[model samples]
Target: MATNDNVYRLQGLSCMNCAAKFEKNIRAISTVEDAQVNFGALKLTVKGDATIAQLEKAGAFDGIKVLSENEPPPENTTPFWRKRESITTIISLFFIIAGYVLYFQLEPKSPFTIGTFALAIIIGGYDLFKVGLKNLVKLDFDMKTLMTIAIIGAAIIGEWGEGAIVVFLFALSEALESFSINKARKSIRTLINIAPRKAMIKRGNSVEELNVEDIRINDIMILKPGEKAAMDGEIIKGESSLNQATITGESIPVHKTFGDEVFAGTINQEGYLEVRVTKRVEDTTLSKIIHLVEEAQAERAPSQQFVDKFAKYYTPAIMAIALLVAILPPIVVGASWTEWIYLGLAVLVVGCPCALVISTPVAIVTAIGNAARNGILIKGGIHLEETGRLNAIAFDKTGTLTEGTPEVTDIVPTEPYSEADILSLAHAIEAYSQHPLASAIIKKAKLVEGKKVNAENFQSITGKGAKAVINGKEVYIGNSVLFEEIGSLPRESKQRISSLQAEGKTVMILGTSNEVYGIIAVADQIRKSSFSIIDQLFKLGIQKTIMLTGDNKTTAVAIGNQLGLSETRADLLPEDKLTTIKSLQQKYGKVAMVGDGVNDAPALASANVGIAMGGAGTDTALETANIALMADDLEKLPYTISLSRKALHVIKQNIAFSLGLKIIALLLVIPGWLTLWLAIIADVGATLLVVLNSMRLMRAGERSSIENNV
Candidate 1:
């Protein structure tokens, strides 16, 4: 079952139903083990060894062309009027008008009139009839098969003008659908075009331009002002302000210096720089975003699943109903054969199901493409739908809502020792520890000029604190529990520690074996966008926003209150956070968890929707969460939720209008009022309206001023 697969690009693959049939045809080939087609991406992947000739033969019915993955897609430079389909449509329209003129001026069945109508049908329906006739032999009842049968029936009933008109209108309808879908697809194509194809590489003294794929890791790439980066790498040489709008959607340019990572598609505004390439071209951030988005577009949501299932039986059922209308009326009701047969043909035209079939996919493709352009990567249609339905959201406290870096805020020393003495001693012991709080202490100590004294016999206690010998005295550093075991703490010191904890500051104690030195308070700064994002979510109908953390209950509750969160769960380990998420799910039907993707993987997997922040910087975040916000800030979260809800609404509207139009047209059969003109117009009009309705999602990516301010 495991084998190397070859992916190929496809041309002229526009219909979802035809794409399915083409995939099946490829699988039937003896040389191919399996094959799949991504209708949204217009790509075909085949397993086993199948020649290009074999694949092309399988797709011949729909006139599809297969190209190697390495081959460049042909540029679409031809004007719309010069296209093959357009030329044929124009000629068919001219012939239909000529035929109608002859019908009113001369005899209705005159040889000239019938000959003109025949030309129109042949010109307009040639491609449709070819594919439809082939599918008909295989008993495939798709939209084309229904239209083909209706056109032929109209011709047999001496309605050449109606048949010719039906052919013209259906051709125009498909053209409109193709145009709208391609407009949606252009959003993704724009992303793929953001990165440059070539880079300037320096080897020893000389620099040469090479393809990005040819550049190896650790190779130095030289970038000049106004140049776009060709690969993902770290800067080793200069500083510049780079516009990272392609990767993070930040309108403002970011300043980058030595050791800063730059993405493949960002633009360098000024200054010269040399970067060390870190990833291959295929593994770059832009490449992964494109791959994920294409896969997301292929994934079906709950509504799409329902529509696909409904269409499977709906098409066959329509055929049976058309058959009964043609036969039963002539027999049981004693109706005229010609009139009822004409009515049956009209019913077939209205029942093509093209509008209903395309309703969900068009909206899904547009919304996902829009999200990607705005630096939000939704992994699947299912997740996009679930995000819109989320009533509750849980947040991880440390890195998600606040800046992860902790800084020392206050220092309290006893009467015998000044603040400087406490900091100097604490810094000596903390120099050997790698804890975050220790870093904060060291940073503060470096700000003042003090003698550096090395601590001897440094030992890190597992859950308590560290102890070491400084100036021939054993000093202890940790929480109150560590010093409590050594000696009793004064009542005033306990009250001071409580005050710092109540302000959401982490308190670190420093002392000797028998006496307390002082306490240092450190806290993480809250992000400026946190309050506004939470408030916006509430206005959008989110009922609850909770924070989960491993910090003390007092600290967690203090921070939660400042952000106006509905609840706070503290002192929770990684697994305990997972349990809390499960509990939230039972209380609220649908819940979402937001976190720094690596540590919160368990809780993220348990929630209905897992959103990861700063995905542009970490590969784990991109792969772990259901939705990845590329920017480091949470400015995009509210916008992502808003877009998903709008997509859901548009899909519902499309489905309702598609079905409503068909029902109205079908009702005309009771009084024999339905004609080929009205039936084809109704069907074509419905399909056009559904496609246009889905296109509205393209404008949803424009960020609000409030979001941009952050």
Candidate 2:
């Protein structure tokens, strides 16, 4: 059975009482199956099969804000004034029309003249005045403040109609700009709203409906058909198909059975499953995603920080310039006060920092959204900016460039044994051993249905191999060192081992008491996409691509050459890998490191930007990576790098465009050629244009498609 649900990442939320109050209103929705709130992470996880439209309608409840809805914003944030921007535009236009009508019809000496001007000021300047007063107290000297100053200044000089028209147009443009920026940030908020709130807990034979936060570890929860799983857990019983699109951005539903891991917020489809909770509600994958997203949003990119710091001084300096333009010109040239003040008002309007303040954030937000849609989660805008500047890329070879799983490829036997017999005997002797190489041999043996032998005395040698008395004969399965210790070694077997090792294969010696039985060659396979990724990186002007692995020199060189890597280092321990990365960083200035799992976590974290291959369920890789690929597809790395570069390019373009327009507008304002309305147009219009341009990153899929054709 399913229940009502409501979910949100509530900031600074504390106590179960707050959770209860939040749940009380959410549960009122008839379709809500369950509601849960985690005070620790300050997130509310809710689940129900209700459509997004239903949840949006339910979100209208008091004190409850749905950060996202089925439909996109202005419906999402749904501010009071935005729903009426068109109406406000019409009303402002009415005042403009009225002022023009009075200017043409009324005589200058008429008593109704004052009323007309007063009506113009009241109609056009009310909202501007309100905003100006609020900002004035906060000392936020923005374009709105400048517009307010210019409008009142115009009124003081008896240009009432000009003042009204200027404030009205400026307010309208500001509203539009605000609306567009909010729309640009819509994707980030949508990503944050993915986690569900309620879970179905199986309490004994009966199922009890509970909030996700109340879910304890090991509690068996039933994920109903078509609903999202509300917590991170293992499926202990039953079967189901799940759509993990929200979490991984994948479109297909993955089939799940007993002992399979299921993530929170993944859609359950086609069947029901009893999932035992493996993680606390606060520690679920969805919570981690939400936490990362929030951190990304709160963190500013380097370019953004630069712009912000620049504006802190830039705005006040512009104000000071406006002051000098007002007094210095009139004093030096003996110009009339009206003429210089008009120049000053123009300066103030032109000095507004709207474009400068908005340039970088818009690009950063767009890039982040673009990355997320492609199954790459960039932790913050800073990481995106840094990634775009990567001069070198270091790769962890084991799981990054090669499939870490090594398999037995070729087997050569000596003297009496055939290849099949050698493999069977080696598998038999090593069956009692638990080493990884031993398991690989055993698995290969099982593939051909090799007979299992009941060995008499099994002796395992530390750091070497295993020996056993099989069918009244002694057998040894180990490396060359073990065979040497036992006694005789054949020249042909040694030659075969050398040839295989030269070809980048691990040669394990299989022997009996005093004779060499065979040589089994095991090798790690290169990832199909690694070669293409290297070429793409080189094409993108990346200086070098290097491989670091714990494998021996032969294996590393072979894999590196096959993948076209510029350099390769082998026989490196974990600390050695760190030293190598640090040395490369010192030479290259900035580097990116990619790896598949946790063993490379330190190197991934130490690099300029850490990219982790996440599809393989490497928790450490996912947790430590600055950029995480949700799919095993390594081709996405090139796309991610391209996207970051494009985003950085767009940010530069925006910053240039904004600053260039501001300079030109400021120069024009000093000469009285630019008016308050024109300044507002330049300020808000440039901001809107840049914001729209930045949002083009969201269409990266289209770009990728075109690139694929090329």
Best by TM-score: 1
Model 2 Cα shift for residue 302 (angstroms): 1.7
Model 2 worst lDDT run, 10 consecutive residues:
11-20
Could you tell me the lDDT of residue 33 within candidate 2?
67
What lDDT score goes with residue 124 in model 1? Answer: 94
**Alpha-carbon shift of residue 586 in model 2 (angstroms):** 1.6
Off by over 4 Å in 2: 1-82, 94-125, 134-140, 160-162, 414-416, 615-619, 669-672, 700-710
Question: Which candidate tops lDDT?
Answer: 1
Give one digit per residue, the lDDT tens place, for model 1 in 1-710: 57899999888776878888899899999878999897877778899999989898888877789998655356466776787887898899999999999999999999999999999999999989998887789888888988998998998999999999999999998887878788787777788788999999998999999998799999999999999999999999999999998888786999999999989999999999999999999899998998899889888888899998998888888888888888898899798999888888898999988899889989998989888888899998899889889889999999889999999999999879888888999999999999988998999999977777779999999788898999999999898888778874788999999899899998889888778889889999788899999999898778999999998899889999999999999999999999999999999989999999999999988999999998996888888899999988887888988887778888888999889999999999888899998999999989998999888787866666323322
How do all models score by TM-score? 0.92, 0.84
**lDDT per model vs. reference:** 0.89, 0.73
